[model samples]
Target chain A: MKAAVIGIGLIGGSMALALKEKGLIEKAIGVDNNVTHTTKALELGLVDDINSLEQAVQESDLVILAVPVHAISGLLPRVLDLVDRQVVMDVGSTKAAMLEVIASHPKRSRFVASHPMWGTEYSGPEAAVKDAFAGRATVICNREESDKDAVTLVEDLYTTLGMHLVYMDAAAHDVHVAYVSHISHITSFALANTVLEKEREEDAIFELASAGFASTVRLAKSNPETWASIFMENRENVLDVLNEHISQLRKFKACLEKENIEYLAELMANANKIKRILK
Target chain B: MKAAVIGIGLIGGSMALALKEKGLIEKAIGVDNNVTHTTKALELGLVDDINSLEQAVQESDLVILAVPVHAISGLLPRVLDLVDRQVVMDVGSTKAAMLEVIASHPKRSRFVASHPMWGTEYSGPEAAVKDAFAGRATVICNREESDKDAVTLVEDLYTTLGMHLVYMDAAAHDVHVAYVSHISHITSFALANTVLEKEREEDAIFELASAGFASTVRLAKSNPETWASIFMENRENVLDVLNEHISQLRKFKACLEKENIEYLAELMANANKIKRILK
Candidate 1:
């Protein structure tokens, strides 16, 4: 199978490499708006060739949208217009907005909505890595909307890359990701801001930052444009989770202010329950 | 040098292994109020033997108070009373309260207030691992209060373990950790609670949890008792930072509520500045 990966950045470049390496695709074509990304993707051998979006879609058997949520929303319908029977898929963070935009499209059955639950803080073609999706869960949203062949092909592709698939509605995917992924990015971004603001007055604080602080704040280094697009795309759900997170933080503040040691201990003990799920 | 490590838990047990592996200590003495911990510490070879506090302090040439901050506050003066010329140091999260407790003791010069900025979410003797402190920063606080030899011994010990040392004032160390360490744990705990609370209603939310969620919430698995003690001991500093963190989070919330994508992107861009410090 031949595949065209749009955007040709981290996720796109990585998918192109993985598909070709695993023999899932005979040739991988890159379609990106960024000239530098296209050049780098080819130099890095992530793709066999670079093509215009319409040309790539017309020539390839598969079209994978791997751009920020907002860009995916704008590009999916246009790509669908240019597709024949090609299996189209997206590897975006939020699903609802993109899926909603294409819900009434004639070639909707050719597009599969997926979010492989994997990424690093880095971005762009330079950040693409092999085996990026291995051992991670990938969510396939509204599978019934996609053609059986298209869905199966996308599922098989993810499975080939060592990703376990979870099926859900696009709306549900957005909500769950709001709780699990979007809010985490917000917390980390806010934490980085908190520490940075503090560090301006007290320069020595960052020296004491250990693995704990680094792990919790590393997401702060993620691309701002990508995340802001995600937050806006999944606005209501992100807001809901952010509000809950703020309330949760307020409880900790209350515990400290009132010196409620027992309650504070109880809160932390309750949090320890995450061990059951995380491990 | 003979070394006694009290509290035989994560920090103490790991310290014992690193010191022994580095040849900084010929024999490691274990001292803990928890009989199970002492037994496990000895079984794991984290120490040569389990001994009473008096025996451990009296027999060893160096003493490490690796218990939680609450226990250290209570044990420091008692440990000092038992010591003659042995260099005593602590590996607790907070330093101000611990140091203040022993500020007027006749044997004050024999004690060093130090916090090794390294730990895992797991705890106890069994969780201890070798080379845990290597390549991390270790802060020695209020070094001028300690005897020159005592300070030198602690510095040499951390250096031998392949850790770089940062000298800090005890009060400053407490405040700094509030920003770098304590606030991260609080954010993680609260995030865990937020998700757990949401999961109670939405069962499938956790299925979509990814590495970003795991990294940000991992510290929620930390021991409740240990963290509670640290929070209460450094309540004022933690509260201050927590307040700042909450306000910072509010900025993200406001951006989402107001649909201010530009400001949202700006906030995350500012957060990316952490890359400069963290890397």
Candidate 2:
């Protein structure tokens, strides 16, 4: 099968590489507004060729949207308009608002919504890496809304990439990811800023930062354009999670103020239960 | 050389392993309040033998107080009472309070306050690994206060472990680590708590959590007994940095609430400066 990947940055570029590496695609086409990204995707062998969105969608058996969440909502309906037999899939971070926008499209069944639960804090074609999706979970949202053949084709492609698939409603997927993924970026950005603000001695930070600080703030290096769009697209859920996170930080601050070691320890012990899920 | 590791937990156990692996010590003696930790330290080959704190200190040419900061402050005086020609060093997270408590002791010259800027969230001897300190910074705090020979011995030892040595004052070490290390743990614990409190679907979290979430929340699983003591011991510096972190988070929340995407993007872009230091 021939595949076209739109917005060929990290996710799209990596997806293009995965499809080609796994022999799931005879040819992978790249489509990006950034000419440099399109050219780099080709140069890096992430895609077979660069093409206009319309041209790529017209020629490929599969068209994947790997754009920002904001762009996905706008482009999903237009892509659905352009497809008849070609299976369309999106790998955006949030699903609810985009799914809602495309819900009434006549060709909605031809489109599948998915989020490959894999990414690094880096982006762009240069950041694309081979074997990026294996051993990761891929969420298929509102799978029932898609045509059976479309869902099956996408699921099979992800499985070929060695990804485990989970199914969830669009709304539920957004809420869960807001807690697990979106807020992580926010706090990490804040953490970087906190150090930048308070520890003006940049030399000390470089001299003193442990592996823990590096991993903890790693997400702060994520693409701002992409994450800002994500935060805006899933505004309510992001806001809700951000409030809870801030409240949690305040609890730690309050406990420290009162020297209430017991309460603080209890909080951390509760958090430590995450080991069961994470490990 | 003979070495005694007082705590026989993560830091100490790992230290013992590094000493053995690098041929820095012929024998490592373990001393922990917990009997199980001592047995496990030996069973895991983290130490050659287990002994009482005084016995370990007296027998070894070098003594490492690798306990929590609270324990280190108390044990340092007693360990000093037992030492004359032997060198003593500590690997605790904080230094100001501990250093102040022993500032007037004659053996203060024999004690070197060093904090290896390396650790994992897990604890105890079983969590120890060989060659744990390579490529990490080992900060020797208040170096001028340590005896010249003792300082040279540690500087050479860490250098042999493939570590880069940095020297800073105790007060500055405490303040800087609050921004770089302690605050990372606080935010990670808070991030985990936020998810556990709001996202009730444990299965969804297990399925949807990406590598980013795993790294961001990694420190949340740190040993509570160890962390609570560190927080209390460095209470002032921690509170100072935590307030700054909250202020930064509030900035993100405000921009998000107002839908001022520009400011939020700028905040993240500024945070991206961490790459210069961390990389």
Candidate 3:
């Protein structure tokens, strides 16, 4: 099948690579607004060729949107307006904004809202990895709203790519991501700022950093443009999680200030419960 | 050289395994106050045998303290009192508090205060892994206070174990670690708590958790006993960093609350500068 992957950055590029690797995508055309990204995606062999969005959408059997939430929301209606029978899915982080924007589109069933629940700190075509979404959850929101044929085709392709599909409403999907994915980026970025502001000497962070610190702060290196668009699109949910996170930090701070070892141990044990869910 | 590894837990046991793997320690005798850890240490081949603290200290050419900070600080002086020519090193997280505890010991020159800048969330002898310390920093604090021969022994052994040795004063080491290491644990635990409280359903966390969330909150699963001891031992430094960290979080929250995309992007861009230090 021919596929058109929009954005052609990390997620889109990776999707192309993974599909082509499995021979599912006989011809994958890249569609990116950034000339550099389009050139890099082709140079990295992330796609078979580059094409205009109009040309790619008209010709491909599948159109995958992997741009930032704002861009996806802006382009979804236009893409849906052009597609005849092709299935369109987005791998953006936030779902509610884009899903709501295209809720009343005339050809809504041809569009599927999907988040692959996978990413890395780096971005652009250079950051794409083969089999990036394998063994990770891919949430398909508002599946009941889409046509059965379109949903089945998307699910089958994801299954072939080694993903476990979890179906949820767009609202629920946004809330879950805000709790898990979006908040992590904020915490990591904030943590990186905390260390950078206090630890003036760069050599010290380089010399003293361990596996724990690196893992915790790794997300801080994410592309600001992409994340800023996400935080803006999903402002309320992200704010809600950030409020809870700040309160949690305050609780830890108070325990440390009072030297309440018992309370501190209890708090850490409570946090350890995350292992039950994470591992 | 023969080495007696005290505590026989994660850090100590891993040290024993690395030393044995490199043939740096011909005989590794494990000394642990906890019976289960001692048994596990021997069963896992983390050490050649188990022994009492007195016998181990007396028999070995080197005594490596790999216990919680509280235990290390409490036991350092007594161990030093018993040592004749054995080079003693404590691989505890905090340096200043423990260094001050045994500052005036007649045998202070025989003791080297070291903190291996590496660990996993899990603990106990079962958590020990071969080559755990390789490619990580091993900070030797107040090295000038330790005898030349003792300091050289540790530096050489750590070098052989594939570790880079960084030298600093005890106070400086404590402060730096509070920023780079201790605060990360607090942030991760707080983040875990935030998610646990908000996402009541365990399945949602599992279904939606991306690599970003898992990596950022991984430290939350750390052993409470080990972390509580470090926070208490480095109370002042930890409190200092915690205050700065909370302030940074508050800044992020205010920016998000205001829906100030420009400000949030700028903050994340600033944080991205951490790539310079971390990589």
Candidate 4:
């Protein structure tokens, strides 16, 4: 298969690498608006060649939209208009907005909405890594909207790459991602800001950061263009989760103020159930 | 040298394992209020034998108090009363309260207040693992209050375990830990509660939890008894950071509500500074 990956940053670049590594694609071509990313993706051997979106859609059997959430909403319909038998998919973090934008498109049947639930704090072509999508869950939104052949092609490709595929509606996917994914980024960013605001001593933060702190704050280092788009696209659900999160923190603070050890302990023990669920 | 680890749970059991693994102690003994812990520690080979607090103080050359913050605040001075040239230390999370509790004790010179900036979500004797302290920082608070001999012995032990030792005042230590450590736990626990409350679909969460969510929420799985005490003891500092964190989230929410892409992008870009510090 000849695959064309658009916006070849971290997710797209990594997906390109994974496809080539598994010999699933005969040739993987890269497409990006940024000249630096285009050059880096080529230099890093993430793609066999750099191609324009027009040319890539004409020649490739598979075309992937792996750009920021807002970019995906704007670009997917344009790509869908041009592709005939070529299978189109997006690896965006937010699905409902993007799906709604393309729902009325003529070639919507060729487009599959997918979110491979895996990412790191880094970005750009240079941040692309091999074996990036293994053993992670990928959520497929609005599967009923895509043609069976297109959906099966995307599913088989992800399965071949060792990802667990699950199905959900675009609206439900947005709500769940807000809870499981979007809020995490918000908390991490706020955490980094909190520490940076309060602790002026840089050396102390560097010296005292344990693995727990590092892991919890890792998403704080995510790309601004990407996350800001995600936060805006899923604004209502994000706000809902954010309000609940703040309320929970306030409860915790009140418990601590009252020295209510028993209640605080119960809260932590309840949260500890996440380990079993996560594992 | 002989080492006695009081309250042989996660921190104490891990310390005992490190001491034995590094061949720094000839024999390591366990002391805990719970008989089950003592038995489990022995069964797990974290200690050579179980000993009483008095027996541990009488026989061991180095005694480490690895109990909760509340217990450490009350127990440190009493343990110091029995000090007969034996260097004693603690691995509590809060330093200000513990240091204040033993500030005027005559045997303060024999006690060292150290907090190893390392831990996992798991707890109890079963959580003990070899090399837990490697490549982590250990902060020694109120160093001036400790005798020269006691400081030297405690520093040497941490150094032998491949840890970097940092010196800071008790108040400063509490503030930094609140910013770097305690607040992370609070955010994580609150995040878990937020998701649990908002997203009622348990199976969806189980299916959609990505590596990013797992990393950000890992601290939520921490032991209740241990964290409740730390939060209560460090309530003021924790509350201060928590308030700042809530304010930060509110700012992000408002920016999203207004679709202020510029401000949202700038906020995320500023948070990206954590990459430079964390890496």
Best by DockQ: 2
Model 3 C-alpha lDDT per residue in residues A20-40, reported as the tens digit of each score:
998888999999889999888
After superposition, the stretches of candidate 1 with alpha carbons farther than 4 Å from their true spots are A201-203, B201-206
Q: Which parts of model 4 are misplaced by more than 4 Å?
A: none
Tell me which of candidates 2 and 3 scores higher on DockQ: 2
The TM-score values for the models, in the order shown, are 0.97, 0.98, 0.97, 0.98
In each prediction, how many residue pairs overlap at the backbone (N, C-alpha, C within less than 3 A)? Answer: 0, 0, 0, 0
Candidate 2 regions exceeding 4 Å error are: none
Docking class of 3: high
List candidate 3 segments past 4 Å from native: none
lDDT of 1 by residue, B1-279 (tens): 999899999999999999989888999999998999988998899999888999999999999999989989899999999999899999999988888788899999999888999999999999999889989899998888889999989898888888899988988888899999999999999999999988764446556778899999999999999999999999999998998898999999889889999999999999999998887
Per-model lDDT: 0.91, 0.92, 0.91, 0.90
True contacts kept of each: 0.90, 0.93, 0.92, 0.84
lDDT for position A38 in model 1: 89
Task: Decide which is better by DockQ, 1 or 3.
Answer: 3
Report lDDT (Cα) of residue B181, candidate 1. 94
Q: Judged by DockQ relative to the true structure, which candidate is superior, 2 or 4?
A: 2
Output the worst ten-in-a-row residue range by lDDT, candidate 4 chain B.
B192-201
lDDT per residue for candidate 1 within A58-107, as digits (tens), equals 99999999988899888988999998889999999988878878889999
lDDT of 3: 0.91
Chain A agreement with the truth for model 1, given as TM-score: 0.98
Global Cα RMSD, each model: 1.5, 1.3, 1.5, 1.3
- Please, what are the lDDT tens digits per residue for candidate 3 over residues B22-106? 9888999999889998888888999998989999999999999988898887899999999998999988998888888898899
